[model samples]
Target chain A: MIGFIIERIAFFAAIGGAGYIAFKGFSAIYRNIMLGRKEKLAGNLNTMLLVAFGQKKMFKRPIVAVLHFIFYVAFIVTQIELLEIMIDGAFGTHRFVYHLVEHIAPLRALYVFTVSSIEVLSLMTFFVTIIFFIRRDMLKIPRLSSIDLEGWPNMDAHLILLMEINLILNIFLMNTADMAVSNGAYGLWLSGIFASAFAGWDVEILHILEKVGWWGHLAGVLGFLMYLSISKHLHILLAFPNTYFTRQTPNGYLDNMESVTREVKLMMDPNAAVPESTEDGPVKFGAKDVTDLSWKNLLDAYTCTECGRCTAQCPANLTGKKLSPRTIMMKTRDRLEEVGKNIDANGGIWKDDGKSLIENGYISVEELRACTTCNACVEECPVNISPLNIIMQLRRNLIMEDSNSPAEWNGMFANLENNAAPWQFSQQDRFNWAKEQ
Target chain B: MQVKEMAEYAASGETPEILFWVGCSGSFDQRAQKITRSFVKILNHLNIKFAVLGKEEACTGDPAKRAGNEFVYQMLALQNIEILNGYGVKKIVTTCPHCFNILKNEYPALGGNYEVIHHSTFLQQLINEGKVTMAEGGLFKGKTITYHDSCYLGRANEIYEAPRKVLEQLDAELVEMKSCKTRGLCCGAGGAQMFKEEEHGRIRINEERTQEALNTNATIVAAACPFCNTMITDGVKGKDKQASIKVFDIAELLAAGQGLENIVL
Candidate 1:
């Protein structure tokens, strides 16, 4: 009679939790798809997935890569087992995966070992998250510091800490619950620990508490999964695509620009082809707003796990320039989100953000000029996110439209105008170096 | 020859099997022109008649295109394409990978279509077809050499083996830098930086590439692209070890196949 009552409680809780997770997951998936469809992605799926799903970029920094790989594998395996446990407990199935394990003792032993391994990994992840929060928040590593926000938002860091703490608490409680179930008088090994923890308690009360613990575990699992899909954790969606599109070849190779006449003609006639019009006059060349980006670039921004691999690899950043490639992507995202809100409401671009905002500050002209076009950041970016291309496009706008360029650029233009090259030397001297030989 | 004259010269006859677009690098870079002139002589020796684009040739816009200026690039490309089309040119041969890449890849975007081959690739084919043979007494026969892959040729187009094959035909011991072929670093002459000052970086990319070649102690550096040839030569000279090492373009090495009687100043 006690078992029957406990099973009934587990069933309803599972149903409620499952329904909530399904609704949130589907809603987030739909929203991201609709958002992506509205903008073109910069790269192909094969390339994006090569980096994103392949975890290609993260592996460049092996320590973080190993930690992430563990957490990723643990999360997947645990969720699958956790779901099976929920369904079997709710339906009172004598057999699920565990049934096959029963007939094969070795398999059962392997299953137990696997479950324990995932639990240990979860514990490590919990610890890593605490460390991650501290390094990013309290101590402040330059690489991990939030580029999106100015000054300290004490409450934001506190909130992140709280979220991680909540996840850890749930993990602790579920482990305790598993221990309780292993320790029962009926002596199911899985429930024996929990049953033993409450050896002095009445069997009836212990059973009821075990069922409650089961529901709590399910609720926490479902909630975290939903949160991961919706929040900035949206990198979960991006990781797959980033990995697939990563360049398999070397970094020195150039990403060839569209042929010149094709680009010019596209500007002359917007209807000629898609790429041509994208480079058209007065239209920002590299990227200004989120909509200017292809869906793949937006996906690249969204998929940034803030791992700081680009920051670590950037020679500019290493040489003490004010630029951080990771931060550039983050800032672009912050600007996009800020501008996206205004655009959605006003039915126009971010022009209403005030003249000074677009003309000078934020992504200033100096920042654009600072980039060396060496492609170190693009090469190091595991997800194949190209911060260089963005800088190039932005330069196009500053040069083409605003004419607010550095003096040297004008000199370069004059050089190319008079000479076929960008040097002050005479066209007659183009072969001078050859003559000396 | 200008593009128009080259076109006219090429079209006035039943189309020759190849039309060599001797870029300004070849026409004016003295040794490059000499080597190219020798390349012509060598082909003449092999009875492979070819048309050379002389004063009528125009810049390929490689300089402007890579300097982040697309306007001049468009103008030069369109003019070149019109000239090439007028000549009824079908297959193009050139020693400049920058020109080869521009003519082969970038030109198509502007609707210019013609088959393009780098000269090293042509030389390898000629040797493989047994159309040419090295005489016993050549300038570089006994030397150990290392070849610098031009950024545009090797990294841009993946033409790593052809130059090495050409070098091998002359029986020179070809060594490799630790980073060769597609993994090869830039000579700092690409992207029209050769025509302009290199923006400050922690290290000069050409110096970095040259130091690797020097580390090999190969005594000689052979190159395909004139830009690489110039940059590596400058780098070697800059290091003040100019007396220790020599740089030669690949065509010059092939020109060594010529007997004393065939030599020109």
Candidate 2:
């Protein structure tokens, strides 16, 4: 009776949670599609599929990509299992796709293959997660190896560790009970060996243990789902749209951004421009906070799977530059979250504040300028995010607002202003090469 | 306000035989100008009478617009559109990819209505119609060549085959870079990066792209865009391997295609 009541509670809880998650996911999609405001969304959709779903970019790091693909495929196929659980709990049918799987022998085998592969993958992921936590918490890799925060946690590191634990524990518990029930006499290959130590237990006790283990699995899954929707690990919502709406062509084209006359009026007269002086003012260019960023870029932040595909392939990061593409997105997200609270409490982050995007120490102007616009980050991003586009936009603000660009850029801009080219060669010489032989 | 407006103008029912809007690249870049003349000469041979708005052609302001100076782009785009309209020049053509992209894709956003074509596309059409011939071109025996796709021409306009066809007509062995066509790397010259120093990053884009062509072992790198040609040529020279590789504009290649080096002027 207790078991029945608990299962009933879980069934309804899942319905409520799933509804909430589905609503948020749909809202994200609606906002991104309606707000991207670029004409190339259709094109990005096709290419993003190759990157996000086909795991095309993952080929750059075969081991990591393979492990990720295993997790991804398992995560996807497990949806059916989840729906089965939900349906079975609600309708009292234990096997939801049981008829379908039983009919097609190959599919049945494929289903079993996927399930067994997930079991092995779960074991691998469990170990990997443990190592990740240990490395971040204990070993302290080169970047953050030494830092310790007790109450005020490094949220990124803490969130990653927490999600890893949740995933690892959920998979182990769910699969362990599955092995115990279905393994029967012959048993599962890998888990059967592990189950051997418990062979002497009474069959009734085993059955009871199996039920307890299954319930534990469901509970873990529910907690994970709820936590995931509300965390920085929001890739679950982002992956769908990121894949579905990836830029069709490569995203590195910094060509003239199509002019926007609809949202904000373009003042062609330079004298008429209203320049925002601080981070809190109406942002003229470059995002000051989460809401300031293009909705697409914000979506990109949420969609990031933390796979480190970007950081691994980043030439800047690899060459010891302080520019990890991953860090840019993480920092932007973090800063936005930080400033969002301030914005809610007060109308702005600046008291017409002297602290700007640069001065406030949210996004260092130098960090924004560190990007080379090399499509390397774009090429390697699994979600097809364009950090360069964001960087370039920020650079635009830097140049126009403060008249503050690096010396090198200033020289080039000067050449453009004077000679219409970067070489500072005579403007008359422009057509000298084209003169008849 | 959108690229489609330009496309509509091009397909407008009353497109003139040709509207030659000599772009800033063609007007200022010597090598580009020669190619622009060659293209014009070919068009004249095909008996296509085209009008040129020479000194009147101002900067398309693509540089300023891309540099986040939209005010300048709008001003220039509006000015050029007005000049073309004043001439009753219903059609437009240019040798520069940047100019071609702007006139064909961006001008209509400003309410300018006119037809536009890149000279390369015009040359291809003439060739298809047998108005221009590749029968008597000089074939340099020892030179192997590869073509660089300008982003505007390749990615923006999807005009890859026309330039490759022009090169192949010259009897040059067209070597392929690892990244070409839609997947081609940038020359670090587009997006007004040509007018600005590249932000500090791990690699220079032009060098990275030049090396890709270098990897193909082609002696001559052929380019469709003057900016790309200049940047790549500089990249090769910067690496101090200029003797092994040289860059040629597609116009130069076409001049070679027609065995018209003497008539190139």
lDDT (tens digit, per residue) of candidate 1 on A107-214: 877766666665566677777777767777778876666463344333444444466556545544544554554452222333344335555666566555655555
lDDT of 2 by residue, A1-437 (tens): 78777877777877688668856644544443333323345545665567667878667658657766766775676665667666667765544555457677787676556556666766776666666677667886544432222233356557656665665565454445445655533233455656655556666666566555555556566666656644656675577677776655424234433333222223444454443432344436443434545666766766665555556544445444456676666655555454444544575342232343343656676566555444556766766776666666666666665676666556655655566554466555544433445
List the candidate 2 regions with Cα displacement exceeding 4 Å.
A1-70, A84-201, A208-216, A226-233, A242-290, A306-328, A344-384, A405-436, B1-16, B41-47, B113-115, B119-138, B155-161, B198-203, B262-265
Q: Residue A323 lDDT in model 1? A: 59
* Cα misplacement distance, residue B30 of candidate 1 (Å): 5.2
The alpha-carbon lDDT assigned to residue A237 of candidate 1 equals: 56
C-alpha displacement of A205 in model 2, angstroms?
Answer: 5.5
The DockQ values of the predictions, listed in order, are 0.13, 0.12
Instruction: Give model 2's clash tally.
Output: 17
